[model samples]
Target: MKKPAKIWLWVALVLCVCTTGLNLSEGRWLSVAIAIVSIIGLCVLLFGQRKAGYIVMCVCAVGSFVVGVTQNMGELGAALAIVMSLIGSALVPVITGLFIKSQWKELK
Candidate 1:
């Protein structure tokens, strides 16, 4: 995968690990759900080859929406989830930019 894709994959992996660990430690309801959703996001990021990844991403998005609404989270939480969805969707390009900057710096 491209650098951007790899970055997003790395972020998703980190989020999954962190969220899972938090859930295990604190037993927070949202923690478990976040971990599951992030894990799904990671799977889509890494192995979503044949349009399956897109479908998975869509599922994740909807899942985020449901979580936001069902929990009755205020605007902040809902906005956060929306932002997270956007990040998950465009993570590859964001990561790619970082790589490019780093590479340019190295060259300089």
Candidate 2:
């Protein structure tokens, strides 16, 4: 992978670990499980040899969308908070994966 792409992957790994830590601290077991899946997806993208890693990334994106949206649905009254949740929890990881797309030919 290109150096820039690798750096993005490392950022993703750190985010995943932080997410796991925060969820565990909050006693949100389900959130933690979802985070673990996301972590696995990032691992596949970082180290796996096949295009299947993209599939894993997409799955994680959708899962994150659902969980992030549902978890923050109650905060709809706070527009700023909702938008931040939508962007932060839902979009950042997908963007991170996009940053790693420089190596698509290698994976293919």
Clash counts per candidate, in order, are: 1, 0
Query: Model 1 Cα displacement at 23 (Å)?
Result: 4.2
The TM-scores, one per candidate, come to: 0.48, 0.77
Per-residue lDDT tens digits for candidate 1, residues 20-69, read 68656866576467557656655654655323443454555465556545
Cα displacement (angstroms), candidate 2, residue 75, comes to: 4.0
lDDT of 2 by residue, 15-76 (tens): 77997898799887777887787777777767774567656656666666566667767766
Candidate 2 clash pair list: none
Which ranges in model 1 have alpha carbons more than 4 Å from their true place? 23-34, 72-108
* lDDT of all predictions: 0.54, 0.70
